[model samples]
Target: MNELSDNEALMMESLARGIAVRAMKDHGAVPPTVLIGNENTVIEYASEALADAAAKDRLAQIARLLATANDATVVTTILESWARIAKVPGGPMTERIEAVMIMTEHRLGSRALLLKIERTEHGKFRRLTPVSVPGLDSVQGRFTGLIPPRSPSPEEIKQARTVLGLLGLSPDGKTIRHDLN
Candidate 1:
């Protein structure tokens, strides 16, 4: 993807900040930052800035938008319209798209999966976890070392389910089915 120019980055950041502010005011909670790009559209929202009740409500609103978005263009259009409504300056469309793609593909957020490391009781170290997100067909044994030792926290599990859901995987997390027909 194309790199974002300094001006474009500033514009995009401004637009995101504006949207977040508006969303916060309307719902009484800060909304997620949206990144738009081909194959990389995503909304990374943190709701803690507002009151606890407001934050949950705002997060739910953000999640709805994210869960329903199916394409990058749609996401960009939505953000552009939001900016216009909020009177925020818009960024270069192409740069926004590219940034979105990079963000989504890399999963750049607090929830993004970082490197997986494993330590054994015998002081041995192993790094056999797959770098890619797991699919339905991905065997549990392949990720035995990667899966969290205890059940994932609700938020973490929710994020995982969302990612898997975006990839069209089953909620059960057993296997991947590509047949959309």
Candidate 2:
């Protein structure tokens, strides 16, 4: 497998975000979606099942399956998901936010894109108001941690070290970061 280019990763991000935002605006929600892009094609995956208690798990499973199947050569994958995020710092405030997690197995790098969303309120008689927040519904965004905590496996560590190396950091060293919420 060859290393994936930054352009490929950015393209995946753009495609996934567009799909997620369109879904959010049309349905007031984002269905868990995955877009796998390679040299000349893009494949999308999404479950048709209803969102239940296991929806998050189901989304992860879908993503893992796709990743495993195409592990050798897929350029990048953007896992678009609807998830809860801390609304405030260390105080238990949380809100549902939009997320897109990206990874590439060619060189095994990963990133997460989290977005806060705000919607316009309905006016009298459920009519739309003129105060609708402009494009993309008033979003604020930043990258987050390594997608949350669970001890990463040996393979995961190796991949991460490669990412660190890309940043000119010690390949076997790790650093702590406090993500912006």
Best by TM-score: 2
lDDT of 1 by residue, 80-129 (tens): 11111112234332211101111122112111221222335753433312
Against the reference, the lDDT scores of all candidates come to 0.33, 0.45
Which residue pairs collide, candidate 2?
Answer: none
Best by lDDT: 2
Q: Model 1, 172: alpha-carbon shift in Å?
A: 22
Quote each prediction's TM-score. 0.25, 0.48
**Model 1 vs. true fold: TM:** 0.25
Clashing pairs in 1: 32-45, 36-100, 37-97, 136-175, 136-176, 137-175, 137-176
lDDT of 2 by residue, 1-181 (tens): 1234456666676677676667766776555555544455666765554456576554454444333333323333334455654455554535655444443323334544445455556511111111111232222222112122233466765665555445433321223354588
Residue 71 in candidate 1, Cα distance off native in Å: 12
